[model samples]
Target: MTETLVRIDGVTKRFLENGTPAVEALTAQIKSGQVTGLVGPDGAGKTTLLRLIAGLLLIDDGTLRVCGFDPKTHAAPLHRVVAYMPQRFGLYEDMSVIENLELYADLRSVIGTERDEAFARLLSFTGLESFTGRLAGALSGGMKQKLGLACALIKRPRLLLLDEPSVGVDPLSRRELWRLVYELVDQDIGVVWSTAYLDEAERCASVLLLSEGKALYQGPPQALTRSLEGRTFQVRNISGERRAVLARALERPAVIDGVIQGRSVRLVVGKGGVAPAPGDIGAGPEAVIAAVPPRFEDAFMDLLGGGPRGRSPFADAYASREHPIDSVVEAQDLTRRFGTFTAADGIHFRVKRGEIFGLIGPNGAGKSTIFKMLCGLLRPTSGTARVVGLDLAKAPSEARARLGYMAQKFSLYGDLSVRQNLEFFAGVYGLGGRRRRDALKRMVETFALGPHLDVDASTLPLGFKQRLALACAVMHDPDVLFLDEPTSGVDPRTRREFWSHINAMVANGVTVMVTTHFLDEAEYCDRTALVYRGRIIATGAPDDLKERARGAGRSDPTLEDAFIALVEADDRESLA
Candidate 1:
C-alpha cells in the first residue's frame, strides 16, 4: 500500500471575510511516489489549496494533515517536509547561478558536503552544469525555470508543490521538467502540480479538479476524458474558410465546443446531441464528419459549460479597412546582434493581409528578437522589416500607428480601473473625443467588461485580464496585430474564447503575427516558421510541418512532435 502524504477533509480557506472562499470544503488524498494534479482555471483555488497543503495558509475549517502532522498546528515542522514553488519562483537575478543555489542552500540549512553534493546533483539533473558562472538574469525562460526547480529541491522535501511550472517555457523544456519531477517521484516524493494546462493534468496519476472553490472531480484524467469519446469529431473537406466554419459550428446549440484543427474543424457535440451532417457546416458532399479521440482539454471545456459560443462581438464591431498592399508584414534578412552574440540571424518571412502567421521555437531561439525588430521595439543590426508598406527602421512611428501589439505579460496599468485602462490606451493610440468614447464603449461591450469597469486591473481574474489586454491592443483598429504568448497560463476554455475573438478579427481582414509556446495553438496559424538557433529551419502550414517530421513508428504526428523532431534534427546536424 502507498503512503498518503497529505489528507484533506472538508478544508476551507478564505482571504476576505465576506468574499467567497478561495477553497471550500475540499477533500483529497495525495500519495507518495505519484503525481496528483490540481487542475482548474484562473481563481479556481488551485494555488490556495497548494498553499494550504504546504502550511503557507491556514485552513478555515475541517482537518488537514501533511506527513501525518496537522499543518495548522505544526506549520514550521510541516514546512521542512514540504517544498512549495509558486508560479513566480523567487530567484535573485543579480546573483550567479551557483550563488543563487548557494543562497537557497543557506536558507534551507543545507551546508558543507551535503550542500555541495546537492548542488552538483541538481545542476546536472537540470542541465545547468555549464552555466554555473552565468548570471541568473541572463538565463533563458526555460533555464530560469530549471534553476528555480533546482533551488526548491536543495532541501529534498518529501512533498513538492509546483504552481504552473511550464507556463512560459517551450515544449522541449516542459518535457525536461516533467522528466525531472517524475525522477523525484520515483524516489518516493509526492508531487502536487497545479497547472492551467489540462494536457499536463492528463499525465498525472490522478487529478483533483476545482471550479469556483468547489471540487468538481477527483479521479484519473482518463476517466473524464473517456466520457467524451464518441461525442468528439473532426469536420473535414470544408468548402469555406475553416475559421468561419468553426465559428458557425460553435454557434450551433448541439455543438458543445469547436476549434480549428489544421485543415479541419474539431467539434465536440453535447452529450446525446446529434452530430452535424456534411451540409450543416457548409462543406461539400464529400465532407467527412469523422469521430476523433477525446482529450482532457475537450472534457475540461465541457465541464466548464462549454467554451465561448456564437460570433465574436469584437469582430462584428470592427470596421474593415482596406490596404493597398497584399503583404501586411515583411521581414527581409532581418538580423539583430548583442555585441558578438548573434541573437537573430538573417531571417525572412512575410504575412499576407488577413493571414495568421505563427513564429515558434524553443526558448532563446530568436523568436522574440525577430518580433521586437518587426514591432520597432528593437532595431535590426542589418536588413529591414516593413509593416503596411512602411519601412520599420526609417518610419517606425508611422508603421507602429498601423499595428497593434500585445506583450507576453499584461501591459495594462494595474493601479487603474478597467475603464481607465481602456480610456488611457485609447488616448495613447490617438483616439480623441467621440472616437475615444466610441472605442472604449465598444471594447467594454464586446469583451463584457461592464461589470469590471470599476475594478482595478490588478484584481481582475486571469481571463478578464487577457480580455482587457486584447481589447486595449485592438482599440485603435490597427491593420496588423502582434500577440506574444497571449494565452501563456490561461485555461483551455479561456484560450478557446480568446482564439474565437482572434479568428473573428482575422476573418475581417486583420493580419496577425504571433509567437506561442503552445504547439496545439500553432494549428490556428495559416503558416508557421520554426526558428532554431536564430535561423528558420522550417516554414509551412501546421500539417505540412507535421508531415515533414513524420517517420516510421510515428504515423500520426502532432505539432509538438514536429517541433521537437525538427529542432533536435537541427541540433544533430550542427554537432556533426
Candidate 2:
C-alpha cells in the first residue's frame, strides 16, 4: 500500500470578499510517488486550495494534513517537510543562480556536504549546471522556472506543491520541466501540480477538477477523455476554407464546441439534443465527416457549461465586416543589442491590416525584444520599424497613439479598482468627457466586467485580470494592437473568449502583432514568424510552417511539433 502524503477532508476556505468561499468542503488525497493534478479554469479555486494545503491560508473548516503534520496549527513544522512554489518564484533578478540556491539552502538550514550535494543534484536535474554563474534574472523564462524548481527542492521535502510553473514557458521547456517532475516522483516525492493547461493534466496519475470553489470530479484523466470518445467528430473542410467553414458551423445549435485544426474543424456535438450532421452547417459535397477520439480538454469543457458556445459572442460586434486596409506594421532589418549580447538581429516582417500575425520562438529567442522595438518602447540598434505608416523611432508618440500594447505581465495599477484602472487608461489615451465615459461603459459591457467594477484589480481572478488588461490596452480603439503573451497562464475558456474578441477586432480592420508561447495558438494566426537567437528564421502561413516541420521529420505535426522541430534542427546545426 502506498503512503498518503497529504490528506484533506471537508476543507473550506472563505475570502473577505463578502464571505465568499474560495474553496468549499474539498476532499482529496496525495499519495507518495504519485503525481496528482489540480485542474481548473482561473478563479476555480485551484490556487486557493493549494494555499490551504501549503498553510499559507487558514482553512475555515475541516481537516488538512501535510506530511503527517496539521497545516493549520503546525505550518512551521510542515514547511520543513514540504516545499511550495507559487506562480511567481521568489528569485532575485540581481542574484546569481548559485547565490539564490545558497540562500534557499541556508533558509532550510542545510550546510556542509549536504548543501553541496543538494546543489549538485539539483543543477544536474534541472540542466542549470552551466549557468550557475549567470544571474537568475538573466536566464530565459524556462531557465528561471528551472532555477525556481531547484530552489524549492533544496530541502528535498517529502511533499511538493507547484502552481503553474509552465505558465509562460515554451513547449520544449514545459516538457523539460515535466521530465524533472517525473524524476522526482521516481524518488517517492508526492507531487501536487496545479495547472490551467488540460494537456498537462493528462500527464498526471490522477486529477481533481475544481470549479467555483467546488470539486466537480476526481479520477484519472483518461476516464474524462474516454467519456467523450464517441461524441467527438472532425469536420474536414476539403476546400481548405477552415475559418469560414468554422464560423458557419458554430452557428448551428447542435455544435457544443469547435476549434480550427489543420484544414478541418474539430467539433463537439449534441448540445441541444441535436446530433451533429454535415447538413446542419451546410457542408459541401467535398466535406468529410468522421468520428475522432476526444482529448482531455473536450471532456473538461463539457463539465464547464457543456463547453464554450460554438461561436464567440464578441464576434459579431467586432468582426461583422470586411474592409481593405494597408500594412499596419513594417519591420526592416530590425536589430537590437545590449552590451555584447545581440537580442534581435536583422529581423524583418510585415503585418497587413486585419491580419493576426503570431511571433513564436523558444524562451530567450528575442521575440519580446522585437515586440518592444516595433512598439517604440525600445529603439532598434539598426534598421527601421513603422506602425500605421509612421516611423516608430522618429515619431514614436504619433505611432504609439495609434497602437495598443499589452505586456506579458499584468501591468495595471493593482491598488486601484477595476473601474479606476479603466478610467486611468482612458485618461492616458487622452479620452475626455462623453468619449471617456462611453468607452469605459462599452468596455465594461463588452468584457463582462459588470460584477467586478468595484473589485480591486489585484484581487480579481486570473481570467478577469486578462480581460481587464486587454480592455485597457484597446481602450482607445487603436488601429494596431500589440499583445505580448496575453493568454499566458489563462484557462482554455478564457483564451477562447480572448481570441474571439481578437478575431472580431481584426475583422473590423485592427491589425494585431502577438507573441505567444502556446504554439497551438499559431493556428489562429493568418501568418507566423519563427524567431530564434535574435533572427527571423522562418516566415509563412501556419500550414506552410507545418509542412516545413514535416519535412524536418515530424509526422503530421501540430503547431508545437513544428516549432520544436525547427528549433531542434537549428540547435543541431549550430552544434555542428
Candidate 3:
C-alpha cells in the first residue's frame, strides 16, 4: 500500500464573499512518491486548498496534517519541510541567476557545501548552466519558470506545493520540468500540483476535482475519462468558420461540450444522446462522424456544466473586406543581439490581412524578441519591420498607432479597479468623452467584465484578467494585433472564448501575429512559424507541418510532435 504524506478531514475554509465557504468539507489524501493534481475552473478553490496545505491560510474547521504535524498549530515546522511556489515566484529580477538561487537557498536555511551542491544539481537539471551570470529579468518566460522550480527545490523539502508552475511555459520546458518532478518523487517527495491544463492533470497519479470549494471527484485521471467513453465524438466536414461550427455544435442541446480540433470539431455528446449523423448539422454525405475515446479535458468540461455560453459580444466589430495591401506585416532580415547572444537572427515573415499567424519555439528560441521588434518595443540590430505599409524604424508613431499589443504578463495596474483600467487605456488611445464612454461600455459587455468592474484588477480570477488584458489591448481597435502568450494561464473554455473574439476580428480584416506555447492552439492559426536557436526552422499551415512529419512514419502527429521533429531535424542539418 502507498504511504500517505498528507491527509485532510472535513476541512473548510471560509471568506466574506457574501459569507460563504471557499472550501467546504474538502477531504483528500496525498501519497508519498505520488503526484496529486488539483484541477477546476477559475475561482474553484484550487489555490485556496494549496495555501491551506502550506499553512499560509488557516483551516476554519476540521483537521489537517502534513508529515504527522497539524498545519494549523505546527505551522513553523511545516514551513521547513514544505516548499510552495505560488503563481508568481518572489525572485529578484535585478539579481543574477546565481544570486537569486543563493537568496532562496539562504531563506530555506541551505548553506555552504549543501547550497553549492543544490545549485549545481538544479542548474544542470534545468539546463540553466550557461545562464548563471545572466540577469533574472533577461531570461525567457520558460527559463524563468524553470528557475522558479530550481529555487523551490533548493531546500530539498519533503513536500512540494506547485501552483500553476507551467502556466506560460512551452511544451518542451513543461516536459522537462515534469521529468525533474518525477525524479524528486523517486526520492520520496510528495507533490500537490494545481493546473488549469487538463492534459497536465492527466499526468498525475490521481486528481482531486474541485468546484466552488467542493470536492466533486477524487480518483485516477483515466477513471474520469473512462466514465465518458462512448459519449465523445468528432464532428467532421465542418465547412463553416471555426466559430460558426462551434456555435452550431453548442446550439444542439445534445452537445454538452465542443472545441475546434484541426479541421473538425470534437465534442461530447450529452448523456442519452445518439451519435450525430452527417446531415444533422448541414454536412454533405461525405462528412464523417465517429465516436472516439474521451480525453481528460472533455470530461472536465462536462463537469463544468458544459462549454462557454453566449455568443461573443465583440462579433460585429469587423466586416469582411478585400485587402488592397498584400502584406499587413513584414519583416526583412530582422536581427536582435545581446552582446554575443543573438536572440533573433535574420528572421523574416509576412502576415496578410485577415490572417492569424502563430510564432512557436522552444524556450529561449527568440520568439518574444522577434515579437518585441515587430511591435516597436525593441529596435532590431539590423534590417527592418513594417506594419500596414509603415516602416517601424522610420515611422514608429504611425506604425504603433495601428497596432494593439498584449505582453505575456498581465501588464495592467494591479491596484486599479477594472473600470479604472478600461478608462485609463481608453484615454491613452485618444478617446474623449463620449468616445471613451462608448469604448469602455463596449469592452465591458464584450468581455463580460460587468461584475468585476468595481473589483481590483489584481484580485480578479485568471480568466477575468485575460479578458481585461485583451480588452485593453483592443480598446483602440487597431488594424493589427500582437499577442504574446495572452492566454497562458487561462482555462480551456476561456481560451476558446478568446480565440472566438480573435477569429471574429480576423474575419473583419484585422491581422494578428501571436506567439503561444500551447501547441494545440496552433490549429486555430492560419499559419505557424517555428523558431529554434533564433532562426525560422519551419513555417506552414498546421496541416502542412503535420503532413511533413507524417512522412517520417508518425501517423497523424500532433503539432507538438511535429514541432519536436522539426527542431531535431534542423539540429541534425546544422551539425551536418
TM-scores, all models, native as reference: 0.98, 0.94, 0.94
Top candidate, metric lDDT: 1
Question: Can you write out model 1's per-residue Cα lDDT over 335-434, one digit (the tens) per residue?
Answer: 9999999999999988899999999999999998899899999999999999999999899899999999999888889999998999888878999989
Predicted candidate 3 versus true structure: per-residue lDDT over 307-339, tens digit per residue: 766556656855566657899999999999999
Q: Clashing residue pairs, candidate 2?
A: none
lDDT of 2 by residue, 22-127 (tens): 8989898889898999998888899888888888888888988888999767989998988989887688899999999999999999999999999999999899
Task: Supply the global lDDT for candidate 1.
Answer: 0.90
Error of 3 at 98 (Å): 2.8
lDDT of 3: 0.86
Positional deviation of residue 159's Cα in model 2 after best superposition, in angstroms: 1.1
Q: Model 3 — which ten-residue stretch has the worst lDDT? A: 238-247
Backbone-clash count (model 2): 0
